[model samples]
Target chain A: MNGCMERIYNGLIKENPTFVLMLGMCPTLAVTTSATNGVGMGLSTTVVLVLSNMLISMLRKVIPDSVRMPAFIVVVASFVTIVQFLLQGFVPSLYASLGIYIPLIVVNCIILGRAESYASKNPVLLSIFDGIGMGLGFTVGLTAIGLVREIIGSGKVFGFQLLPLADVAAGKSGYVPVTIFILAPGAFLVLAGLTALQNKVKNNAAKKGKKVREASGCGEGCASCGGCSGKVFPTGNEEE
Target chain B: MVLSENKFMMSSSPHIRSKTTSANIMQIVTAALLPAAAFGVYNFGLPALIMLISTTASAVLTELIYQKLMHKKVTINDFSAVVTGLLLGLNMPSSAPWWMGALGSVFGILVVKQLFGGLGQNIMNPALGARCFLLISFTGQMTTFIYDGVSGPTPLAVLKSGGTVDTMSMLIGKIPGTIGETSVFAIMLGAVILILTGVIDLRIPGTYLATFAVFVGIFGHFQNPDIGFFDPQYITAHLCGGGIMLGAWFMATDYVTSPITKRGQIVYGMLLGILTGLFRLFGGSAEGVSYAIIISNLLVPLIERVTLPKPFGKGGEK
Candidate 1:
């Protein structure tokens, strides 16, 4: 039970897929124009991730070592197709807004990465917990970025107007939107800012003598390397 | 034990030293910019003056605070921030709110300049980069120029829409444009000071203007079919109007962003010319000087690599 909770905590904070691992940048940058789109895309990807992880973990013993990649893709694609039809039938607006990105979730590195590194070796229950944690982490990241972009870019949050817009024609002066925050460059800016903020928090925690994992190069869960972050425990001497 | 200072400090070549410092060069450039800034204030009213002051103050304070917090050496005394703020101020519409100028200056100093490594290490002209940032972010505010207490389209905008402009008025600076760019004579006055002080040479600006003129003359007629090919009036209007004059003389010649190699400077200038021409004539905007110079600034590393002069008597590739 403790180990299961640790896996959840690990994915949500220590090795967050969006902020730390930097996986699935395509969907992370795109389809995050608004908070609603972000939440919808995130939850859809979560469903696919959780289901794929469970199936892959169950069939790990039977799958051939040489053809595991193809087998993983087939399983993931099947789950993705189910999620796609459900979304299309119920949430048509979100489906249209997250166009092309829903299908592209098959290639999202976070889902496949978790399947390859965690699920392929872990027990089915542990793998499901890992999927939930990682999925929630990605959802939180996307939601944060989307909230910021929507607020600054259009002065709204989740389709509700938070800032009073200055309508010059109506002579009611208020906040003016910096539209660049919603544009393509805004994604890079916001991502950099959030990443820097996360690093600052980690550094500050490390300074207070807390146990913080440091990434050497790998995404903190490399099955091939036997966990790279465990080897080089940073002494807090090297500052970026 | 008292450590005695060594008489000889070992360093790389270009051993010949000069008294000139980065601060000295920056101060000179700041002085040169005064004429155009003065002209801008005269052309507009108290708002233009306020804009300049606010921007300069914002840029300097941002730099000071950033350096202080980071425990780095404070370089505000060098006057580069002053120059950057002034340049950004000059590029802004006088009608723009003062906070916009302040925001631009903050962005220029903190994000574009300091974040990349202060002074010499920045990837783009900080002023131009911030100006482009503001331009894209607030298109309506940036482009709304006021002349003679009335808001109207600039000479470039008029010419872009196939209307003739008074070249004499544009040359003499009685036109609606950005704070400093309206006055060709003022920019030339500043350019002369730059040349006299040896702060800049004609290589980059000269090539840039000549190529731009040639490009406009050749291709501009196609855009405005009413104007015949190689029309001098059309070409002159382009050269005189908008930010081209200020950009060619000042921003494109930035030491940090422009190419260092002699031959590379020429290529950079030609690239600037073609890009400005393309953006102005073919793109969605009426002016492209700021965008052109910045894009060229990004390519400076490549230009320097290709145009690197062979070291003395190094044999050809074996």
Candidate 2:
């Protein structure tokens, strides 16, 4: 149980896909112009991720390692198509706003990364939880970036006006949106800022003698060992 | 001379040291910029002054507070922030609210300067970086040039739109543009001071202006039918009517962002000229000097790599 919980915690904070792993940057930067678009893209990716992780884990024994990458792509792409149609039918607005990104989720490194690293090796129940955790982490990162960009760029939150617009023609003083925040450069600026903020938090936690792992290219899990290779699971099962 | 027990001078290279420091050089730059900044105030009135003061104050304050929070030694006394703030202020439209300048200054100092490891480590000129930031963020506010209580299109804008402007008025500082950019005469005066102080030479600005002039003479008439090929009036107006003079003389010659090698400086200058001319002639905006300078600043590393001088007697012998 503790191991299961650790996987969730690791995904949410210690190894967040967007903020920490720095994966799926294409969708993270492109569709995150607003909070709604961010939520839409993130959740769509989450659904695809969860389903793909479960199926890949179930078929892990039959699938040979040589063709595993192609098999993973096929599983992820099938689930992504279903989510695409479901979104198109039920939530047309979100589907239209999310546009090409929904289809592009097949290529999102986070989903595939978890499938190859954790899902293939871990138990069925644990793989589902890993999918959920990583999905939620990506959702949180996207929503935060989208919320900030929306507020500063458009003076809106979730499509609702948060900051009053300045009417220069009427000589009224109020908020002036920094329109560049909605542009492509704003994505980079906000991502760098939020990533830096989290690094500071992680560093502070480390300074207090907390067992915060050092951040390598990916995160604690990937950096500590090669996908937790030759490690004993908390469930009392040891992988050779 | 006998050295005292505790006063031993152990240093490398030549023992002779000049009185010049970063602070001293920055002070000279500040002094050189005073004429243009002063003309901006006179031309634009109280609002320009307020904008200038707010920017300078905010830049210095941001540096001070950032250093304090990060527990680094305070270097605000060196006046680099002051020069950056003032340069950014001069780049701002006079009609822009004072807070915009303040915000730009904070962005320049905190993000562009201090965040990037402060003064010499910044990849781009801080003032130009901040100016571009503000210009993009607040397009309406940054481009509106108001003079004599009426907003008018800048001469460059007029030229961009197939209309002509008075060259003499532009030269005499009666034109509508950004605070310090309207006055060619005032900017030249500052440039002369910068030159005479031995702080800057003509290598970068000279090649930059020369290339830009040649580019304009060749391609400028394509956008406007009225402009003749190799027209002297068109060339002078191109030179005098925008931020090109201010940018070439001050911003492009930034020590940290520009290439150090003499040959590299020439390549950087020519790149600036071509980019500026390309942007002004074909780009969506009327003026492109700020963009040109910042883009060239980004290319300095590549230029330096290409133009690096061979070591003495190494290449020939090997």
Candidate 3:
């Protein structure tokens, strides 16, 4: 149970597919012009990833090593095709928006990587949880990027008016889109900024962990008098 | 500590030094570009020549000014400014306003190259980056290509407008385009000279042209049923048309932005070719050499990692 929990938590935060691991960048940059498209693509990819992982885990032992990669590709491709057709039929707008990226998801590497690394070795239940966690992490990342791009690129969110563009048109202030945000270059700038932010947060947490260790005096439970090595000095005098 | 000091001094890395400095290389590149410049002048006449000279001079002047302002050594004698200016001039349409061409050159040298730590430190080809900036900023003016006595559409523009250029006119330097890009034969001559002089490796240009030919052949047939499978002549026409030759031979093979290893060069060239073909086919532009080169430049670091050469005498380890 603890192992399963660890796997789930690790995928969600410690090893996020988008922010931390930086996987599936092609689709991340390509289809993230609008929030609606981002969510649509993210959910579709998540569905495919989860289903593929669950099926691969169940059939892991039956698969041979020599033919494993081809077999995994075939399974993933089948799921991708089904999703592609379904989206085309039901959500035609999203289908048009995503365009070639739907076909490209077959080679996304993130889905295939998890299927090979985790699913093939883990139990079906654990694989399923891992898929959910990773998929959600990818979703959060894509949505965050999409929100920033959309709000700035078009001054709209999910195709609805958040900030009043009409007010700007009527000589009012505070509604100007940095049109570059809708273009490809903006995707790189946003991704780099997000990655830098994640690094800063992680570094801060690591520093706090180090300070806590120093204050705890190596956890030795020793009682030495004056000039003892285990003494925890007051905060002001710690630097001395 | 004594042994470490001795070993450091005796280290075998960077074993060779040469009289061939970056300044010398830039000068040679500018010299090699002369054939294309002459051809451009012949095809486009006096205005094109004037624009080219002004662009180059302004680029050099801008670099000097920036260096002076930043309190850095004014290294305009290196001739990189001239190379960038000529490349920028070659990228603009023959009849472009002198001011626009000069502005493009300034952007190339000052903003794209110098602002990013100058010369080798720039991530993308500065000339192409500035060209893309001009294209986006002034689409109407930038795309206005002109031919001899006929101020009209370019071959790519004609194609986009549902027409085809006379193949013979395109082959000769009579078709509409930038000064240097007007003649495929002249560009090839310059490329051959550069290769013979060892200014550039044959790998990048060779792979880039081959890959572009393959894609054009495949896609051209798919689009037009009349054009048979494996249309070699269409591939040639695609190569000769627009900036394909200029980019494949000169711009895409830029040493600073391109990968160093042979394998990485091949991958980078092929990727540039595929992306160029795709953008030409699907995107708004009929010619995508600038965007394609920039995209490939961004991937060079990754390609280097994947194709890194193994150290001698090192066995595989876990």
What interface RMSD do all candidates show, one decimal each? Answer: 0.6, 0.5, 4.3
CA lDDT of B174 in candidate 2?
85
Instruction: Output the number of the TM-score-best candidate.
Output: 2
Residue B309 local lDDT, model 3: 88
DockQ scores for all predicted structures: 0.65, 0.80, 0.05
DockQ winner between candidates 2 and 3: 2
Docking class of 1: medium
Top DockQ hit: 2
By TM-score rank, best first, the candidates go: 2, 1, 3
Off by over 4 Å in 1: A212-240, B1-14, B315-318
Off by over 4 Å in 3: A1-240, B1-15, B159-162, B315-318
Write candidate 2's Cα lDDT for A7-84 as tens digits.
567778878999989989999999999999898888888888889989998999989999999999999999999999
For model 2 the local lDDT of residue B85 reads 95
TM-score of chain A of 1: 0.86
**What are the TM-scores, per candidate, against the unseen true structure?**
0.92, 0.93, 0.57
lDDT of 1 by residue, A1-240 (tens): 244455666677888889999999999998788889889988888899999999998999999999999999999999999999999999898899999999999999999898888888777766777798889889998998898899988999999999999987798989999888888878887888888899899999989998665323434353443322323321121111
Candidate 3 chain B: 10-residue stretch with minimal lDDT:
B1-10
In model 2, what are the clashing residue pairs, if there are any? none
Of the native A-B interface contacts, what share survives in model 3? 0.00
